[model samples]
Target: MEPLVRLHGITVRYDGRRNGGLVAITDVDLDIYQGEVVGIVGKSGSGKTTLLKVLAGLIRPVKGEVVFNNHKLNGNSFRVGVLFQSPLLLPWRTVIKNILLPIEVLGEDVSKYLSRALELIEKVGLKGFENSYPWELSGGMQQRVALCRALIHRPSLLLLDEPFSSLDAITREEMWMLLQDVISHEGCTTVLVTHDVREAVLLCDRVVVIGGKPGRVRAEVRVDFKRPRDLKLQYTKEFNDYVVMVRGLLGD
Candidate 1:
């Protein structure tokens, strides 16, 4: 079967006209299959997030094509959902209203998606907090609201950029489990850009390592571990091996 999304020879450069410019990423190629969770791992400035933006159609590559479901992607024309490090929820909006923000922005019928919004809120364990404002919730709870917002439209692709990096270690682990469940339940193809190697190993079906001054794919490690992976898996020697391998690729 064809991949859900394909990036061919993607290259991104910043501020090229004045100076020679900085090359963010060069000749990066990738394919994301349906229902697969792919992680892009590297040190700071590895261009992981830039590659993600290219896929999301938020950044146009200097050279290369982004194809989604066979056709070349144009602008923000494809169905996609994005979550960032910060929950970035509107402070005044209630949880349910925040979750429904995308629907309203897309000019879709909010009434038609209300039921789905509620279902997602429940799925993310934010059921009773629907009426609560952002200020009333804890950081973790706020992130849960963000997750609900990302999934409300049932996007084909979910782009997560260090979504859990800001949380406490304990809360981040909890979110790992929560995100795993949500992705499995929603069956959305996801591309996650993170600095956390363990997070990549735990949540990704495959991890791609990008490295060097001009970031490029250094290695692609397939995670063959069974599903419903638990926190205990992180303690095992096998899991650490994967972590070590990715670290090695990053020149750590």
Candidate 2:
């Protein structure tokens, strides 16, 4: 099948105050297929987020091209949903209203997506909290609202930057199941940037590791675990083997 998105020879550089331009990533290439989850795992400065930014159209690469749906990316031409580490929900907006914020920003008719928003609220286990404010919810609940908001637009691609990194260990594990459920049902192509090797192995169809001073694709690991994978799978030797391999790639 043709790739849903492809990054060809991607390179990003930032101007340093004293050290001239710093190259974040060099000649990085990747392809994401429809309805597949791919994870980018790397150290703090390995350009995982930079690669995601390029895919999100939030950053223009210093070199190379990004092709989405077989066409070159052109200034927000494609529909994309992004979730960062922080939920970033508006304090005043109710859960349902917050999910509808994207519709409002896009100048679309809110009534048209009202039903979809409500369904998503239910989908993310926030059915009863639709009218609740962000402050009324727990950290995990707020992130659930953020997840609903990201899917409210029915985006073709979902870009996640460490979306579950902020939660406690138990909550993060719970979120892994929740996220797996959501992605399975929604069937959107996803690109996730995370430092957690176990998270990558647990949730991704493939893992791309970036390393070195000027970050580049150090290794790519294909995960073949079955769907609806249980947390018990995490305790198995097979699962840990993948994690250990990815950790090695990250130089952990």
Candidate 3:
């Protein structure tokens, strides 16, 4: 099968005052398949986020090209839904309004996406709280709203950058299941950047490890766990084996 996105010899360098001599990542290559969850894990300063920015079209590499849908990705990035560590909801906007924020930014008809927003709200278990403000909801709930907001635009790809890292342990586990269910239902391809090796093993179909001063792909580990995996899988040796393997690749 053809890859949805492919990166060839991607290299990004910073030339500002503080980061003048830094090459964030060098010669990084990756392939993202349709409907597969790919996790990127690395140590601090390993350029995990830098690689993601390249995929997002936010950072143009100094060398090589990013191919999406068999076409070279230029300044115009393909539509992608991003869920960051912070929910970053607008203080004044209600839950439903927050979800529709992307549509508004794209200068689209808000009324046209009203139903879609509501549907996403319910899908994320925020149905009755749509009218409530972000301050009223818990951290997990706010992240749910953020997830809905990312999906409201119906983006071609979903990017997750340690989105659950801020939540409590129990809440993070709950969100893992919720995200898995939502991704299964939506059938959207995903790329996740996380520091947690366990998270990558549990949530991703394949894990890529980046290392070195100028980050590069060190190793790729494939997880063969079955769908709709729950927390119980964490106890099994198979799950831990995958986690251990990925950690080994990270050399941590």
Best-matching candidate per lDDT? 2
Q: Write the per-residue lDDT of candidate 3 for residues 11-87, one digit (tens) a residue.
A: 99988797566899999999999999999999989998888888888898999899999999976568899999999
Score residue 246 of candidate 3 by CA lDDT.
81
Model 1: residues >4 Å from true position, as ranges? 16-18
**lDDT over C-alpha atoms for residue 218 of model 3:** 97
Q: Could you give me the TM-score of model 3 versus the true structure?
A: 0.97
In candidate 3, which residue ranges exceed 4 Å CA deviation? none
* Native-to-model Cα distance after best TM-score fit, residue 4 in candidate 2, in Å: 0.4
**In model 2, which residue pairs have backbone atoms overlapping below 3 Å?**
none
Give the poorly placed runs of model 2, Cα more than 4 Å off. Answer: none
- Model 2 — which ten-residue stretch has the worst lDDT? 243-252
Ranking by TM-score: 2, 1, 3
Which digits, one per residue and each the tens of the lDDT, describe model 1 over residues 9-127? 99998877777799999999999999999999999998988988898888988899999899899998788899999999999899999999999999999999999988998998888
Per-model TM against the reference: 0.98, 0.98, 0.97
Hey, what RMSD does candidate 3 come out at? 1.1
